[model samples]
Target chain A: MKNSWLALLLFVPYIALAIDTDKAFEDPEMQARYEEITAEVRCLKCQNQSIKDSNAFLASDLRREIRRLLEEGKSNDEIYDFLVARYGEFALYRPRMSGKTLVLWIAPALLLLLGGGVIVNIIRRRMNMPIEDDLQEPTNT
Target chain B: MSRFLLPLAAFVILIPIFMVGLTKDPSELPSPFIDELAPDFTLPSLKDPEKTVSSSDYAGQYALVNVWATWCVGCRQEHEFLMELSRSQSVPIYGINWRDGRSEALRWLQALGDPYVASGFDQDGRVGIDWGVYGAPETFLVNADGIVLHKHLGPLDATAWERDFVPKIGGGS
Candidate 1:
């Protein structure tokens, strides 16, 4: 069909955003921090995608907001606090240390101790076995 | 026999945990503003852009703040219920017309019944961002002290109104 060119216009918005996301941050370190922060924060509506990776309108809004905060000289911790204060801990890809999350944070150590206890119990039971039992021939008589 | 029993016990425990998770809507985020002061804002009124509405205007009164938009399908689905609820006069409802055209919102409200006492025109959605509004049709129940008591993330229906808002208000559904 000769009219297929009109279908390509649908991609204009994506092209616009491609140019927008590449606009540089003033300081290189700040840019690195910006990239890390965006990658770390979850897009609330699009739960699986980080803000850096999402094309959702809400994600774009968040990216703009995060940049504004960065420009205002807010630290990454302060930005996290700001997001968590409004959106709750769900926005954080990595949860903070808190009473509610204590079990999650300590689970690995608990599992390690449990595994060690099982191993020690098995070794203790084996320690009493005779080492010379197989050395002698069987007496059929 | 002991090894089989240990895993059986773990399986029994996991059943209840998984069942509880099944009933929850994973898309719903836990409301962080519950028992906290409702975030403050003053935006142009949706009905008349020249006049502004502020969160403080609803202070000293129990109110419902609804986030909506002409572009949101959920908002359209919930509009009829909102109109009916407005007729009942149980509580005053405020609105945030988020990231939507002021003209289109006004036209929609005019064509449909106006449920919100004062709707804020959140043209750029900055106020919505401040309120942690990730989705449209989120509702907040605020007490007379201006503390946000509950947040309903999806469209309001009779079931949620009875289950969530009624218990908080201590009223018979």
Candidate 2:
């Protein structure tokens, strides 16, 4: 009887500790979605840090809000819509490729093509010219 | 000719090993949570008036740093875990108290516990902002190299310490 009571005494606190463990592992689907949205959201306080990377109170609250929303069965689009309505489009880490963002999306490719064209044109001009004749013509002139 | 063939064969055989090593698991990339260097700042130490501490203060140690404010209830909820972790590991624990009254912070540390080696008082939270801290009770595991190796967004607990952190870093459970 004493041994059983001793085991019970030891086991009770451990069992209580184990009860709290579920908080860390609870709602796998919700947790995964929480991660996705946090990654997508930008932290306003930190320069260019995603909510996932920030440890600020606002970021933490936002993350908890996301988790709560997910637990309430809100879809990713719905969560994003809620955030956009509150914080505007700047809340997203990857700004959408829309009309206003078209420049942001296209400018790099356009610049690359322009640069390549200039280089190719210069190379072709150099190749087409007769170097020896060009030098001789300049000297003759 | 034989030497060249052997070298070529060795190169061919080693390619797969090299590729496997280079293509590490995405999950293992040190969650953007605490992958970067912890931001540097010298804040007044809560315990000592004249002394100041910064990220460089823990340069040669494997430190678990927690950011919390006395006003934050979540920090209180995670208090036991911090105490447990401190007791369990030889690693040092440091705290950055963000935007809280200095007296309350000191009182809380005195009442609940003081697992922290030193606590920084970030009165304005500018240092917290620089560290990318959005909330209270965010914890970072910084390697000896001063690179943040892992981050726990919410409260810390035994299960998280074992499953997520210890296994990832090959530390004792």
Candidate 3:
């Protein structure tokens, strides 16, 4: 009885993990599509969690919808466009490049360039100042 | 002085942007369906499962489509206010009884009061997804042409109706 209880205790976590697994898809291609789409779609109820990771009802509904769309032979872009049309761009984990999101995509590179320029400018100024100091040192000597 | 001024200006400019980001609720995402034609769906009536209700029933009239569930605590909180709104008859209210047991929903309406013209039973929440409902207790205002005017998340109160809804409906509150 004690050995059986220990075995059950060890098996409990695997059961919990299985709960989040997607429903069985008959086609392997459809299963792959399901995995890819769920990973990219954010659970709107839990903004931080992907639909695959979330247990929210909305997430499950979205997963089922994705499966249904895939079965209907809709392309990935069409699926994404459908979700974005209803939930807005926020539904996508990787936002598309558009007029509104142009800044978001460009800002990181712009800031890095600006920072690098500042560092190079400071180093050049330091190098030039040291040359002037070296020249004055000879005079003192 | 010039060196300090550049960073100072950057800091000053960033403060307001950060403040706006901090004040805004990240959970309250903007729905893209606003001003777009409301998605058409045919769902069974909660009371009579055999009969169905569709979006076309509310054509040529401003209507409120309220997504609710018996299990959602927020729905209970807003039920009284919905009842009051139904009594006023300012706009016809339609309910999407989303992902709920039929018997529980029917009993809930009986115990509180039926506020909807017809409550659609969304057994699997397919229609709720079409409406872009992330959570329960989302209310959408549909114009006469079946265009979604606005979507309000969370429990609605008198203040929310006055501020977010009244002006859109052209009724001064």
* Candidate 2 per-residue C-alpha lDDT over B115-145 given as tens digits, one digit per residue, 9 for 90 to 100: 8888998887666655656556778888877
Clashing pairs in 3: none
lDDT of 1 by residue, A1-141 (tens): 556777777766863445126566979999999999999999999899999999888888888888999999999999999999989888989979898777878999999999999899889988988767777676787
lDDT against the true structure, per candidate, is 0.89, 0.74, 0.90
lDDT (Cα, tens digit) per residue for candidate 1, span B1-173: 77689779889999999999999989988888988999999999998779999998888888999999999999998899899889999889999999999889999999987999999999887999999999998999988888898999878988889999878866421
Q: Could you give the interface RMSD of each candidate, to one decimal? A: 0.7, 9.8, 0.8
Worst 10 residues of 2 chain B by lDDT: B25-34
Off by over 4 Å in 3: A1-16, A132-141, B171-173
CAPRI tier of model 2: incorrect
Ten residues in a row with the worst lDDT in model 3 chain B?
B164-173
Q: Report the C-alpha displacement of residue B163, candidate 2, in angstroms.
A: 1.6
Highest DockQ scorer: 3
Order of models, best lDDT first: 3, 1, 2
lDDT at A83, model 3: 93
Better of 1 and 2 by DockQ: 1
Per-residue lDDT for A42-111 in model 3, tens only? 9999999899889988898898899889989999999999898888889999989999789989999999
